[model samples]
Target: MTTATVPAPSTRADAPSASSAYRLSFGHLLRSEWIKLTTLRSTWWSIGLVALVSIGLSLLMATSLASFAGDVPPMPVVEANRQAVQVVVFSTVLTQLLAMILGTITVTGEYSTGMIRSTLTAAPGRVAALFAKAIVLAVTMFVSSVVVFTAAALVSGPILPTGPLDLGYPDSSVLPVLGAALYLALIAVMGVGVGFIIRNGPGALAAGIGLVFVAPILVMFFPRVESFQWIHDAAGYLPSNAGQSLFMGSPMTGITLEPAPALVTVLAWTAVVIAGGIAVLKTRDA
Candidate 1:
C-alpha cells in the first residue's frame, strides 16, 4: 500500500506562477513601463526631436551671434569664445518641446491604444502603475536632454572659435546647461501628469501648447493694465518661464520669484497635476 505509485508531478498548462498569481511587484511594473516606453514609435520621435532642436536652435543663435560680432569690441579669445558658446547652450527651446511630447505619450498613448487596460490588469495598483510611468518618463527625458545638449555644444564649438565662442570650457555655464536638462525632464513629468488627467490627445496637446505659448503672450500683453500686470509678473513664475531661468545664469530683474522659488513653483504645479491624475486613475474603470 505504501508502495502505491506516486503520480508524476502534473504540469498544468496556464498555471500561474506563485508570485504572479498573488500580486505584482514594483520592479516588475517598472520593467513593464520601460518596455512600453521603448517600444513605441513616439518615443523615438521625441528623442530625435530633442537632438534636432538642440542643434538647430544652437545654429540659429550662432548665426545671430555672428551678425552681432561687428557691434561689440573684441576681447581675449577664450573668454570671447566662452560667451559665444553660451548662446548655443542657452538656445534649447526645442528640447523643451521634445520633453513635453515624451511626457504626454507616457500616459496618453496607452489610453489611446487601450494598453492601459492590460497594464491595469497586470498590476491592479493604480499608484504603482503611475509611479512606474513617472519614473520611466523622467529618466528617459533626462538622458535625452543630456545627450542633445552635449551634441549641440559639439556642433556649435567649431563655428564659434573665430567669433569668440570657445567650446568645452569646464568652468563656464556648466550649472545652467545641466540645469536645463533637469528642467526639461521635470517639464516632461509635468506633461505626463497633464496627459493623464486629460486622457485625450487633442485636448492635452491644445492645453499644453496654450500653457506654453498663448498664456505667456496674453500675460505679457496685459502687463500694462494694473490687474493684469500682476499676471505678467506671475507669468514669469510659471513652469515654462520660471523653470527656464535654470538655463540662464542671471535672473530677470523684474521677475518676482527667485530661482529657488520658481523651481518650487514648478514642482508644486507638477504635484497638483500628478495628484489629479492619480485620483482619476484610482477612481476610473479603465
Candidate 2:
C-alpha cells in the first residue's frame, strides 16, 4: 500500500490569514493609532518635556517651602497634598505645549504627508477613524500625566529635609491626583479637536496655544469691559481655566470656582470642541 506523504503544513508566507488582508477593525485602528503615536519623535519629546518640567518644578517648590515655613504655619499634610496637586497640575503647561504639537501631528501630519486619505480609506468612516485616534491619544495622555505627577511628588518629597513629603495620605490626595491626570488627558483631546478644525499645523498650534494662554490673558485683562465680560465667562469655561480649578485647593487670590463645577465646565468645552471638529472633518477635504 502506497501512502501519499502528508502535505507539509502551509507556511504563513504561502497562505496568509484573512486578518493580514482585512480592512481596519476597532483593534486594528487602535494598533494603527498606537503606531502613528509612537513612531513620531515629537510624541516622545513632548512626553519627556512634561516629565522634566513637572519634576523640576516640584523640586523647586520643595526647596522654596523652607522660606514659607517662617511666616506661614507649618504646612499640614493636607496642605502639602494641595501644594503637590498645584505643582503637578500646573506643570501640565509643559504637557499642553507638547500635546499641542502632538495634536498637530496626529491630524495635520496626516494631511501634511497625505496619509489621512489612506486612513479614511481604510476605516471608511471618518468618525470611526477619529474615534480610534481619540481613544488612543486620550489613554496615552492620561497614563503619562499620572506617571509624571507621581514622579514629581516623589522627587519633590525628599527636598524637604526636615519632614518627609508623604504621598501616603489617601484622604486629600487621591482624588486631586486623579483629577490632575484626567484634566491633562482632556486637554489633549481638546487639542486634537482643535487640530481637526484648523487642519493647518501652524494654525492649529497657534490657536491651541492661544486658547490656552492668550484667551485667559485677554479675558482677565478686559473682564471689566461689557463686551469682554462675556468673553471672560466664555474663557473661564475653557479647558485651561476650568481644569486648573482641580488644583485650586487653597483659597483663591483672584478668581474662584468649585472643583465640581470647574470639571463640568471643562467637560462641556471638550464636548463643544470635539463636536465642532467632527463637523469640520465631515465637511472638509483631506
Candidate 3:
C-alpha cells in the first residue's frame, strides 16, 4: 500500500528565530522615541509657541533699539555685538519654561497613558530606553531652538540698527546662537530626568517649573538676606543662571560664573539629575 507520503516541515538554518526577530536594538529604541515625540500634538504646539515668543520678542527689541540708535553714542563693536545676540536670546527665559513643560510631558505622558509598560516590555533595558528618550528630546529641542533662532535673526535683521546689530556680521551671532540651542537642549534633558523621577504629568511639570523658574527667584531672595549669603553665592551655580551665562556670553547680574564655568555647571546639573532618574528607574517598577 503506497500511501501518500507525508512531507515534514523544513526549518532553514538561516531563518530568524522569534526572539531574534523581536529583539530591539539601540537604534530601534531611538527611532521609537522619535516617533512618539513627533506624534504628540503638544510637541507642535510647544514648538510653535517657542517660535512665536522668540521671533516676536526679537522684533520688539530690535525695533526699540533701532529707535534709540540715533540718540545713543556708538558703542564698542564687541559690546554692540553682544547686545545684538542678547536681543535674540532674550525670550529664552520664557521659552525655557515651555521647553521644560514639553520635556516633562514627553516622559510623563507615557506613564499617564499607561504606555510605559509596553515601552519597557519592548525595550527591556530601562536605562537604554531612558537614554534613548533623553537623546531624542535633546536633539529635537536643539534643532527646534536653532531653527527658531535663525528665523528670529532673519526677521529682526532688517529692523536692527546697522553695524553691530547687523546679522551680516557672523562673528558674535553664530557661537552664541549655537550655545543658546545647546542650553535649550540641556534644559529639555533635565525635564526628561524630572519626568522620570516624578512620573506624573502635572507633578513633573510643576517640578520642572520650580527648578527652572521659581527656584531662581527664591534663591535671589537669599542673597539679600545677610544670613543666607552662602546660599546666595551658590546661586551662580544654579542651572538657569549658568545657562544664561552660556548663551549670553557673559554672566548675568550677580552671577559670577564665566561662560566656561557656566557650561560646566549646567552639564553637572544635567548629569546629576539624569543619574538620579536612572537610579529611580532601575529601582522602581514602571
Candidate 4:
C-alpha cells in the first residue's frame, strides 16, 4: 500500500540558530577590531611611549623635585613626601597623546583605507560594530595603562622614599594608578567616538586633543581676561581636567568640579560623544 508520503518540512538552506549566530557575529566583530588595533605599528609605538613616559619622565620629575627641595621653604616631612610622590602621577598626561592617537586611528584608519565599508558589510548592524570598536579600544587602553602605571609606581616609589618625599605607597600609589588607568581608557575611547564621528584622522586627532587639552586651556586661559574671567570657572568642568580631579584627591588649584561631580562630568562628556557617534553611525552609510 502506497501510503501518502508526508511532505518533508521545507528546510531553508541559509537559516541557522538565530541566537548563536548573533552572538558569534558580535564576537567576531570585536576580535576583528582588536586585531586591527594591535596590528598597527603605531599601536606599539603608543604603548612604548606610555612605558617611556612612565619610566623616563618619572625619573626627570623626581630628580627635578629633589633639586628644588633644598631651595624651598621647609614643611612637615610627611606632607612634603606626599606632595612629592604625587608628581609621578602626572606622567599619565604625557601618555594621553598616545592614547588619543591610538584611538583615533582605530576608527579613522578604517575609514581612510575604505575598510569601513567592508566592516559595515560584514556586520549590517552598524551600531554594533561601532560599539564593538569602542569596547575593544577601552579595554585595551585601560589594561595597558594599569600595567604601565603600576610598573612606574613600583620603580619610582622607592626612589621617592630615598629622598625626603614619602612614597605614600600603600594608598597613594594604588589609587592614583587605578585612577590614571581609567582616565587613559576613557580618553582613548572618547577619541574613538570623536574619530568615528569626524571620520577624518587628523581632524579627529586635533579635535580630540583640543577637547582634552585645548578646550580646557581655552576655558581656563581666558580667565585673566576681564569680560570672560568667568570662563575660568568652567575650566574644571572640561573632560580631561574634570577627569583629573576624579582621583588626584588633593583639591586642584583651579575652580574645578568636585571629585564626584567631576566623575559625572567626564562620564557625561564621554557618553555624549559615544552615544552621539553611535546614532550617526547607525544613520549613515559606511
Best by TM-score: 3
Residue 59, candidate 1: C-alpha displacement in angstroms: 1.4
Model 2 per-residue lDDT tens digits across residues 1-286: 8978855567445665666667357988999999999998888988988888888877777778755666665677877766656655666655666766676668888888899999888876688788788889989988998888888877766665335435588646777778778877777787888888998889998988887666666655664666655665566566677767665452212244578888887788788888988998888877
The sequence of per-residue lDDT tens digits that candidate 4 reaches over residues 90-179 is 776667777888888888999999999998888887888888998998898888877876676566655553443344554544555566
What TM-score, to 2 decimals, does candidate 1 have? 0.82
RMSD of each: 4.7, 6.4, 3.9, 4.0
Q: Is candidate 1 or candidate 2 better by TM-score?
A: 2
Q: What is the lDDT of residue 64 in candidate 3?
A: 95
Query: Which scores higher on TM-score, 1 or 4?
Result: 4
Off by over 4 Å in 3: 1-22, 162-171, 223-227, 250-254
Model 3: which residue pairs collide?
Answer: none
For candidate 2, report its TM-score: 0.84
Q: How many collisions between residues are there in candidate 3?
A: 0
Q: What tens digits encode model 3's per-residue C-alpha lDDT throughout 1-286? A: 6879644434666666667956688989999999999999999999999999999999999999899878878777667778878988989989999999988899999998899999999877799999999999999999999999988888887777754354555667677888889999999999999999999989998988988877878875554666877776777787888888787865443357777788899999999989989999999999
Off by over 4 Å in 4: 1-23, 68-85, 161-171, 223-227, 249-254
lDDT of all the models against the reference?
Answer: 0.71, 0.74, 0.85, 0.74
| Structural RMSD, model 4 | 4.0
Local distance difference test, candidate 3: 0.85
